[model samples]
Target chain A: MSARNHEQWTSPPKLAEGEWVDSRIYSDQTIFEEENEKIFKHAWIPVCHESELKDAYDFRTMTIANEPVIVVRGKDMQVRAFLNVCPHRGNMIERRPSGSFKEGTPSGTPKRMTCMFHAWQFDMKGKCVYISRQEEGYQDRLCTADVGLRELKCEVYFGGFVWVCLDDDIGMTVEDWAAGALDCLAPSLNEEPLEVFHYHKAIIPCNFKLWHDTNCEFYHDFLHYHNRITGFNDAYFARKNSGFKNGHINVGSFEVQYDNYEGFHSREELSFPHLPPNHWYMIDMFPGVNFNLRGSALRCDLMTPLGPDKVMIEFRGLGLASDTPAERQTRIDHHNSIWGPFGRNLHEDLLAVTAQGSCMHPSAEKRNILQGRHENETIHDENGMRHYYHEWGRWLNRSPSNPDEEFDEALIAAASAKPAEVQANA
Target chain B: MAEKHASTIEQIKDVIYKSCLYQDDLEWNSWLDMCSDDYHYAIRAFSPEIRADMEYMGGGLEYMKSLTQMLPKHNTDNSPLKRHCTVYKVEVADDGKSASATSSFVVYQTMLDGINSHVDAGESRLFLVGRYNDKFEISNEGVKFSDREVRLDTRRLDKGSHWPI
Candidate 1:
């Protein structure tokens, strides 16, 4: 009921080990580097949607764990990913965020990703098609066959998203890694081809995991006035928060009463295929990705960690590719009312996580972040974050409650174990 | 004829400046008063990543007023905003009943007591830079905004604002 002194404030709370985590996991530089190596490199990340590269030779470039990556659509209608670095001098092959190699550039021929540095050209399959003056430069030492781009493991799944993994040896497919977390939206998203109607990104000054934590739990709905007005009902409070294997979580569906908010109307007319009117569902994947479906529109948040205290979040709003112009406009309105930059709720989330980042700076005093609320694993419970940090600890082999200590397998057995429902689905 | 046209342009400029001032001061009532009952407002930007134009916010007058009324109940940054605008072109109708203007604007946010104020207090950061495409209805009473579209150039809003820019 009162403020504590320094000693009392710094000590761990009187809670179970898995119910709390050390703040250093969010602020330490070493832990951030280890996360890139241990967690992100092996995880299947949905870099972009397939609809983005509908035309032949169209491509998109992004970074995964600070390594430049390019995803392209070939003439054979296959999508492939490769390291955007050239084999000659390690220069970045493509500088633009997105474009098509279908036309001839000033330095290279058509239908090829040409490195402006040495004009080394790579074909749609990432095969080295041409090396400028190859015989004159290296004689027999090097040939075009020896200098192909390093291709990454790529797949198109879960509603036509282009998923990529940095580790070629990673044994899990995107569906296996999902572990039933995305099953809730599978029917709706897979029912038809979806096209992204809106796109924007923000570079927030916060750890990437912090943003994921906000998405994993609904306890912070109190911070969103719009949600309070439209969604504080019995169904909302009773929505189950289910944790799946590999740190994934899903919040069960509940119909939103959009009419409760002034100047807002029900979105029943444009609900996704096979979805009930005004129903809301969410999927938080392992590491940092979120998919939120609010009846009419789908919002996907893809996070790329930039530093210990910075992360870049790309937000996209999608609707059916067959939507009429009027239908698409309605879906965009539904999406922007709550998820857009000037939406009623999104900026509030950014405000809170950035504040957490400010307090948890590496130089600041260390403390415990409690995730101990237990409500039969319902909407307001904190089990989602607990499950996430448990998996995070296992990956880095460091204790969540005490990062200086080595992780003990027995400490978080309860949180790490898959729920019976998840096991049954698996 | 030239003198009368110059006077009409000056009136249009005054309306644009006053609108910015009212919004920057958070005087929602005054800002709304300068808008017609059918006022349409929107904020838009083009994203190269998606290769499309995006409308971040849009509403009619009633919708905007309702959002403003809910602002106090929401969690928002308290940083004060100051807008600098330059009216570049104003074209008046032959009947003097309507006009259109194009103006460039830059909004700066001064830290007061928001989350990052501990380290960024008293500092002014460039919040957003955009061009405003505006339409007005001129009358004997005064000039009022009929439509305004804010086309922004800066896409990355570090800590985004609840208020429209």
Candidate 2:
């Protein structure tokens, strides 16, 4: 809205020959809604790590694609997800984000998911148990089988994260979805079983894609002063970018000497099993999953759209579950140093996307995501962004190069077949 | 032991006020000067996401010292943060060498850029509300913060500044 020459800043930037995305992708409500349906709904998103559900009946509530979902561990020791809504009047069964059903009900009626509205009770398997005076109300008409909570496709992987898919019949497994994207870190994640040490939520004013864009764009490493001092080195520049079959991206497996940065002590104390003390790895999965291992700590965060312009990032820091009290403390300290909410880098990343979002509006003109670099052997390339959009464009049924082009389903299916091979043409 | 810990409540209040003032003014060095040798500063908040009360962020004395030292090298928000702290209770230890103090504090961030550069520039938006659960080591030299845990009631720290609250 600020008066600026259209000749200069208004034009969309080009990333590569075929990798330019208009800013309308962030500002367009129609496109955003379509994304929620086609992309977000069908994709497998890791909502919570299994450690979050420590005990039987322990549950964690999360909202993905504006849908409230509850992932709970049952007495059978299986983690299952149910649509948090009740089948009767659509009231949310459990209001608290997380708790144990084993705590029983207010009337002390064993383990049941009870709706606070009319106290409609259901068991951990989402089976409708006591429908509050069911005998008097249409007895035969309303049995537990007819009123159970809707179940979702849920899977636990790497003994690490709980992956869920809103699409029940979606033709893909988490292994097929991630393929080799998370393979590098899987060994390390489960080397000794890691538990979350730090967790924080940030609801920022930006489109859901803006956060992922920030993660996929390595050219913006200059924006982080601490990264400049420590993370960006000869190894950093030599780090290669790889993409997987389901649109997951891996930016690096590089080394970063934390002691090289001013005031940061040498990270010689503790580390993940497979990684060196001062190493860095970043993985940006499709939809809304990002896992990054930097130095001696592991940070996994996911964001989903709250609205067209609002998104929430739930950040978690993981450390060896078998770590001693002193080791855990060190992990906590190191995690907070850079990856914490008060850290030097994350807020900076959020602010940059926030600034980009401030310029976009549904009524305003489209913006550009120019990711033209193809260094091939460095994290500085835009290949990560290119691969991300390649999957996004496929899912959204649109072309990244041309947003206004009519969506083609066949094109989407074709690209989905070999997404890893989908890349920007030099 | 009581005599050794006998720093007056009024004296403790001054240390709390001075610490808040130093933080608000972005005087990192001066703030560190007031911290005891083993000073540990921490910020904690209840996380619904984690479903537990947890430390969102914090560090020990040397770690905090390094944090403050390294902060200036990073890019922080130019906006100024003003902390309003009220000392509620000061519990002196039986030995009197140390005391625990609690205060309800509110921090506001005021934008200092652009045309809004007058009395209007002073207007601020409430950024955080928390209680300062602090420990002070009262010595012959003075009272210094040994451990300050800012247990924040709010968890939506979307874009917080570089410095500790």
Candidate 3:
């Protein structure tokens, strides 16, 4: 009941295993690097929406686990992803974040990804089309056909999101990876083509998983005054948190009473196709990706882990591509009111995670992060995080509650067992 | 006529300065008083990454007032914002009923108290840098802002603010 000494403070909580996680998992540099190798490098990450690269030869450049990747649309109208490095000298081919290769640069040809370093030209399909003086330099030893940009496994799925995996033989498509986690909003997202209307990114000082954890659980809704005012009814409290395979989690939908807040109105008219009026759904994919659909607008958060203590989160807001100008404006208005950089809710989430980051630094004392709340898997329950860390442990081959030890299946099994079974075991 | 224009410009400059002062002081009601009944406010930025112009936030006078009034209830950064503005150009309407002006502004935030206040207290960081494209109505009452567009050059706001910049 009172403040404890150092020995008691450092000990684990009274909850069963897998009901809590060690702070070191968020602050350790070695574990951060290991995550890049075991989880992110192989995961099918949604790099960019297809609408961003609408035309042939238009490309977007981004990074996954520090590896620069370029996604471009070829003349054949196929979206492809490749390593941004040039084959000749490994120099990064595209320096710009995004642009069209329809026009030729000073050192390159038209419709080609040109490496300014050595004038090596690559076609939209990643074929090495031109090499600088190939015949004179090495004669038959080297040819354009032998060296090409490394292509990655890419697919446009789940409502035109361009998903790419660094590992070519990962043996699972993006749909398989999702494992029905996105079924809640699949109809609405796929009902019509969507185009991004707003985009912004923030580099928060926190582990990438911490951001994903926030999305998986609604216990932190108390921190958001806007949500509390608009969504504190019985239905909101009864919303379920469902976990899927591969660490994905889905929060069921509920009709948000937007009229509860002053100057706010219902989003029924502008809601996405097939969606009920004023409803909201959220899906949190493993290793940090979030798809949130709030009736009128769709907001996706894509995380790129920069370091143990830093994560760059890209936020995209999308609406139907067939929307009229007025409709699009209304969607943008609804999106910005709660989820924008200057919105009523997002800043509070960022503040909460940043505060956690500051205290869980590498030198900070170790502590237990409790995920023990059990409210029959309702919105406020912590079962989502408990399920997530179970997958995290399996992938990293380490324990979530005690990282120094190997992962133990019995510990997690006992922790998440039924109340009667847990009591019997005790 | 030249003297009248000069005095009008001075008054316009005073209105611009007072707007920033009131916002920095968190005097939301006073800041709203400086705006006309039909005032429009927007914060915008050009994203090179997406190759588009994005409106991050926009609202009318009533909406702005409501949001600002609800700010204290939300969890927000307690650090105070200090806006430094320099009015660059102003043009008075031929009828002398309205005017348009552009000013450069840089906002700095001093960390006062938060989770890491023990270590970050007294530290100041550049929060945002932008230009204000403002339109004012020169009515019988006084100079009131008719429209204000904050075109920001900085896009990445780490732990962004709930309050307008």
Ranking by lDDT: 3, 1, 2
Docking class of 3: medium
- Kindly report which residue pairs in candidate 1 clash with one another: none
Taking the candidates in order, what DockQ does each have?
0.76, 0.53, 0.78
* Model 2: per-residue Cα lDDT over A1-426, one tens digit each: 566687766564532334567778887888888888898889888898877788898999987777889998999999999999988888777777777888766643657788877778888888988777887886688777788899999999864789999998888889888889988788778777778777877887778888998887788888888888876667888887888877898876776777777667766568688787677788999977899987678898888787677788888888888989888878877887787888889878877776666666567676666766667536887778767877787777677656788555455345333223234422
CAPRI verdict (incorrect, acceptable, medium, high) for model 2: medium
Q: Which ten residues in a row have the lowest lDDT in candidate 3 chain A?
A: A417-426
Model 1 per-residue lDDT tens digits across residues A246-288: 9899999999999998888999999999999999999999899
lDDT of 1 by residue, B12-44 (tens): 999899988899989998898899999999999
- In model 3, pairs of residues that clash are none
B117-154 per-residue lDDT for model 2 (tens digits): 44346667888999999998987897888999999987
Q: Supply the TM-score of chain A against the true chain A for every candidate structure.
A: 0.97, 0.92, 0.98
Fnat of candidate 1: 0.76
**Model 1 TM-score, 2 decimals:** 0.96
Superposed model 2: Cα runs more than 4 Å off: A1-17, A407-426, B1-7, B112-123
TM-score of 3: 0.97
Candidate 1 residue runs with Cα over 4 Å from true position: A414-426, B1-4
* Most DockQ-accurate candidate: 3
TM-score of chain B of each: 0.95, 0.87, 0.96
